[model samples]
Target: MTRARLKLNTKQIRARQRAGAVRGLHKAVNHLHERSTAVAPIEETTLINSAVASVDEGALRAAVSYDTVYAVRQHEELTWRHDPGRQAKYLEGPLVEESAMMLELIRAQIRRSLR
Candidate 1:
């Protein structure tokens, strides 16, 4: 004879998932920020250093930003030139290129949280 029972606390699971997602998103955004920094146009270095990665827990949203007056211009102004290996769309380029890895980061965190 054998007996088996299962009980699932969905509320707890959801909380775990939410926490995991937030953590994962934070990590992903930070990585993106770092990647962007590596490629961001550098003068006084403010643009590259202003990089910030944030996750809104309430909205379950995330963003990576460069808080500089010239950030948008530097990113959008295709006419502009930089030294050696730096150019426009630093943030956008890395984000687009690494989106899959970002998702994987989130997934990995969620999987870890479940265990």
Candidate 2:
């Protein structure tokens, strides 16, 4: 009678999994930041460049920010850029799509790790 034997280091496996999850999170955040910047209205380039993304350790969530004095004016500028009567949802639309994509990516990563 013969039996197969396997050796597993749980600590090492857990470390690798954590590293992969972190990498996936960082990738998602970076993707969001890039998408936001691309969709942002740019005249002087300051607003677009101000877009930034980071992961919150406490919440394990990705957070994005457009840290600029004129961040509040984003809506007004986008809305009135083409026509004052119609609102141009440049930032919000792209952000929603990007967020969905990022979520899907993370889910895929999780599935892959499980395999």
Candidate 3:
């Protein structure tokens, strides 16, 4: 009979877990940005192209935004007319509709990173 024991460092394990989580968060944010862009109102493609995803590592938070002068107005104005398949609240709609999938994306990335 043979017996073997292996010792693992808890600190290293924790760091690895945190890194995995952060990677997941980044992926999640990018996922949101992508989905939002797909449904975003496209006027000369300015708003769609201006989309950006930002993650704050220390705060463990992320945001997807469109950097345009009229971005807010375009997102909020329900009365304004857009193309047949487009309308106001483009980002908000996607954020709500894709919430579940986004979370899954984060979880999957975390698992992958851990491995």
The lDDT for every candidate, in the order shown, is 0.89, 0.68, 0.86
C-alpha TM-score for every candidate: 0.93, 0.67, 0.84
Q: Candidate 2 lDDT, tens digit per residue, 2-115?
A: 999999888977766665576678778888777766666667878767778898644567777888897767644643563232233545666677878887767666556656
RMSD of 2: 4.0
Which candidate gets the maximum TM-score versus the true structure? 1
Best candidate (score: lDDT): 1
Summarize candidate 3's per-residue lDDT along 1-115 as a digit string, tens digits: 9989899888877777778778888888888998888877887998998999999888778999999999999999999988877879989998999899888877886677667
The count of backbone overlaps in candidate 1 is: 0
Worst 10 residues of 1 by lDDT: 78-87
Ranking by TM-score: 1, 3, 2
lDDT of each residue in 1-115, candidate 1, tens digit only:
9999999999999999988999999989888988888889988888977888888989978999888887898999989889878879998899999999999999999988999
Give stretches of model 1 more than 4 Å off.
Answer: 1-3
Candidates ranked by lDDT: 1, 3, 2
Off-target runs (Cα >4 Å) in candidate 2 are: 1-18, 76-78, 82-90
Q: After best superposition, candidate 3 residue 95: deviation in angstroms?
A: 0.6
